[model samples]
Target: MVMTNFLQKRKSVRDFKNKEIARDSIEAIKNYIEEIEKETETVSFKFYENGSIIYNGLKGKAGYSGVMIEAPSYIALMKKDEEKESCLNTGYYLEKLNTQIVNLDLDSCWITLDNVDDETKKNLFGAEGTKVDYVVAFGYGVGKKLFTPETTSGRYTMDQIVFKDEIGNEISADELETTGLLDIFASVRFAPSHKNSQPWRFVMEDHNVVLYMEKSDEDSRSLVDMGVVMFYFEEMAKTIGRYGKWSVILEDQDKYLKVAKFSM
Candidate 1:
């Protein structure tokens, strides 16, 4: 299946059957990880067959807020350099991998490892400078991979999340349709965020899309969330014959943190 089809059909599966992913699927995941590592130099991944170690730490963890789900296998994501860009790259890279997993006829859920104990961190990926950002559980789900109304998991509509050339001015669906970006923006709206905060806002410039984040005083996981949305935007754009690359902009640092500009 194409990435766009998977994007529309995929739902986060919290329950999985007691079965292993096919060896070929595992191989495909590893190969894709290698490619993503090359593309995003700061990110790295490791796969674990035994989910008990990670699952145990997730139990009653405050950071994860007791929402971690169990599965037969897990993928641990780590970053080499602890910088702002590294966090963004972590989300960007993992979502790409997640999309690939969906395309492979598998199910996955992004599991937060923020509150994992020290010992488990040491055992899973090591306790060095490598910062473990997140883990994903993947396997055959207990049911079908269809997006029901309940599974759609409501997101902020385009008017609420996107803007017209500036902040506060909501962009209408009709305007997006006229620009041939309605579908592309729709995919961005579906991108998952920490706590479903949906903290991103896009400013539609002439033939370009400038990304921004809602105001926050402290360092945010939402930066990672922004990268995840960008991944969706770029991939869906490509699938529909719209191509562009993201470039960071430095001018708009006051009203909002200028994340990137997608140039067509």
Candidate 2:
């Protein structure tokens, strides 16, 4: 499952059953993190609440009942200080780990700086230069009310934000449906961004997918935001069972680029 399908399946799992996480799932998650770390060399994992409250702090709303007792357990993703684009790398790599969790049939929701507990954060991650850019909460659902009309309505559509070319050149919602790119691109629309900036763009050069970072976009953590978007496209390809590899490409234009062209 890709992150969007997982996102479609994902709900704010507020009420959770008191079930313990399976050992195999735990190992799988750890192993997945290890694999990513080996490849990207920036991801680190930490557990909280035994898988119940993965992230807490959304403006001091640490939902977990126990400091360590609230949820089953939580995983905190951190980027190493040495990595050049650590934050962006963290987002991209973590989403890959996240999607796999969904493929395993688990549920989770991403959290920003506001929803986590600062007290334990320093211990879970580091207090200095090592920043915990993003957090995700995962666990078994308790059959609780997932979303309100306001929440679902808030999700931005392709037309509302995405463009056929650039930010101003808006593409019609109806037109997007008929295009073959929708299934893959629509998933990018759902990929999480810091403060919902949606700081990503795609340039299709024949069979290549050129990723561009608009001027305002700052890859504070290396291409972490771009990584999140890449994760969406990767998962979408897999949903259709499409196989491909990604790489960094450069364009001789005014804008900064983080290209990940796919090949069949």
Candidate 3:
């Protein structure tokens, strides 16, 4: 399947069959990770066949009750710096991996490591400087289910999340339709976030799109969530031949924190 279609079909799977992934599929995943790491050079990933070590340690953590789905394998994400940019890069890289996993006919769910125990961290990373950011549990799902955009989880509408040239001025669907950005904005609207907070805002500035995170929603994980949304936007844009890149914008500080700018 094409990248855009595969991305649209992707959904969070919390259940999986007790089956190991094919060696070729695992190799493909490793190669893809290596490729992305070389491009970003800001994150590292480690795959573990045994999920029990991380799963058992997550027991009794808030918001994880009955939500921690067991799988045949898990991929641990790590980074050296604990700064904001590092967290955002972590999310960006993992979402790229998730897209590749979906294309391989595998399913995954993003697992938080905020409350992960020290021993579990040691067992997963086995290093000191690099900090664990998140984990993705992936494998072949137990049952087949057809998915569509409507079947996915609820999300904020484009108008609620996107703006026209400035914050508080929400972009209308008509404007997006006229500007040919509806599809790209739709992908950002559906990007995953912690508790589905959807704490991102975009300003359509000429040929560029400016990304911002709500000041109140600012946190380590939210920065990562912004990166996820940014990745979705960029990927969707690429499908339509709009090639651009992200650069941090640090001059603004107020209601919304300027995270990055997409220069087209």
Candidate 4:
């Protein structure tokens, strides 16, 4: 499958077969990781089996069942370097690579603050000055459809998640289609947030999509979330054959409010 096709087909998978991923598949993952690592200097990855020490930390931890229990293979996404928005960049670029993994017919789930074997992760990656923001569990799921939580878990619609100019001024789904903005925003709506907080808002003007942080906090971690959403927008745009460029526009001394516009 093509990368964009993979992005469209990919969803979080928690149920998996007990069998290990194929050696060729593992090699494929490693090669892809190497290529991405070269482009994005901050990120690296390590793979492990389900029973290995890497996956043992959360064995007895509460609320770790569901998809996490059955991930026969694990990919530990690691990043190094500080200063600037490093963790956010880690999530952004690593997820782009994960999208490619979907094209390979594998399953993945992003682990943020839950079901993580911290010590084992650190040992495997060997912590530097950097922090392990999160990990993604990957493998071949058991059945065709693994029942994504989006159905029962609930998700925000385009109107609720995105705005045209202000928080109260919602961009209706119908209006979005008329404006041809739905394709990009659709992907942003599906991008994962911290515990599904979805603390992002969009201001669509002309062809530019300006990202603004709306939550109570704009700390380092939030920048990581920003990076995640940025990746989603770029990938979604490319998937739909609308290519755009992104850059961080420093607006204030605080460095919280960011502007990432799209240009034809």
Candidates in order, TM-scores: namely: 0.87, 0.70, 0.87, 0.77
Candidate 4 residue 96 Cα shift, in angstroms, is 1.6
* Whole-model lDDT values for every prediction: 0.76, 0.60, 0.76, 0.63
Clashes (N, CA, C under 3 Å) per candidate:
0, 29, 0, 2
lDDT of 1 at 157: 79
Off by over 4 Å in 4: 1-10, 49-51, 61-70, 81-84, 113-121, 127-130, 143-154, 165-175, 217-219, 250-256
> How does model 4 score by TM-score?
0.77
Q: What is the C-alpha lDDT profile of model 3 across 1-264, one tens digit per residue?
A: 554555566677777898888889999998998898788766888877676766675555411564676888888887868778887888888998898988888988887766666765675568541377578989987654434566566777777778888877866788777767787777666677777778898888887788889866457778888888878877888877777878877445777779999876
Worst 10 residues of 2 by lDDT: 52-61
The list of candidate 3 runs beyond 4 A from truth reads 2-8, 50-63, 143-154, 170-174, 250-252
**All-Cα superposition RMSD per candidate:** 2.8, 4.9, 2.8, 4.0
Per-residue CA lDDT of candidate 1, range 1-264, in tens? 655555666588877888878989989988998888888777888887777766766566522347667787889888777676776787788898998988888898887766666666776577651377678988988865435557667778778878888887978889888877887777666667776678788898888888987756534587788778888888877876777878855344675778889976
Q: What is the lDDT of residue 203 in candidate 1?
A: 90
* Worst ten in a row by lDDT for model 3: 57-66
Number of clashes in model 3? 0
Q: Quick one: RMSD of model 2? A: 4.9
